[model samples]
Target: MMGERILPGSYFQYPPPGFPSVSPHRPSSIPTDLERVYIRGKGSVKDSVKEEKLKDKPGFEHLNEPLHVLVEAELPKDVINSRLDYVVAILENLLKPVDESLDNYKKQQLRELALLNGTLREESPRMSPTMSPSMSPFNGTGMKRANYFSQKPLI
Candidate 1:
């Protein structure tokens, strides 16, 4: 949770990394179908806005499995046992990533990375889909692209 800034459209594991390794949520117990998630937060389960958020619902969406994310400030033992799936861990990854400000250069770097990783939709294709993977854009020399981008700060 402390290494680098979580940029827009970047995928990260919840409870990012400074917390102790021995967490109650070890990523396996989470339910594949999140419809059974029970949230302890204020407000009804489905508000008008929630339905819209569900269209682009957050999760490993490429796999076609939508997850129901439950938010609870404090986990109640009785509530845990009542749900179809159990709460693996009690975590509160605050909205700090959304609030952080980034410079134009950093923003561009994130954009480029997103494009390379296919996270962000590309405005234009540099190469056609028909292009073979073996063929290099520059030449077929098998030269490795220099990557200077690192999420961790160099000390």
Candidate 2:
């Protein structure tokens, strides 16, 4: 009895159903494609910086100056104004359709609301306090009652 093993009863029915097995070949380290690209880009940037440093040495000083000077050249005020006007026109053209559609949508919604209001009014006619005496507890009676807390004591 010392060596004998006690087996627990099976919880599932006989001929148990098989489940889909998980893949055994999982990667040891998850590789991120973006991280790899970023690292590669970082290395290229470092190399470019090193190249720029090499070009900045004593013999290559004159080569560092920009080939063209843009600050001295000035465009006419009319040309700048024309460009600004063109940009504004393009923006207006892009927004015109959207504005029209929004206006039309608002009009349609107002019409729908008006129709709904008309239907609701027709379904239940407006009733005055005089028309339904049973519904209103105070039917236009101006009589006032003394407040319980503010009542005067008998002398």
* TM-score per candidate, chains pooled: 0.18, 0.15
Query: Model 1, range 101-142, lDDT digits (tens) per residue?
Result: 533333555576677677986533545657665564555564
| Reference-based TM-score, model 2 | 0.15
lDDT (Cα, tens digit) per residue for candidate 2, span 1-155: 01111111121113233311111131112122211101111112236666476555775442354321111112355454444344334323322333433454334444555675674232224346355554543434533565787877876
Q: Candidate 1, which segments miss by more than 4 Å at Cα?
A: 1-35, 45-91, 94-96, 99-122, 127-155
Candidate that scores best on TM-score: 1
Worst 10 residues of 1 by lDDT: 1-10
| Each candidate's clash count | 3, 0
RMSD of each: 18.9, 34.1
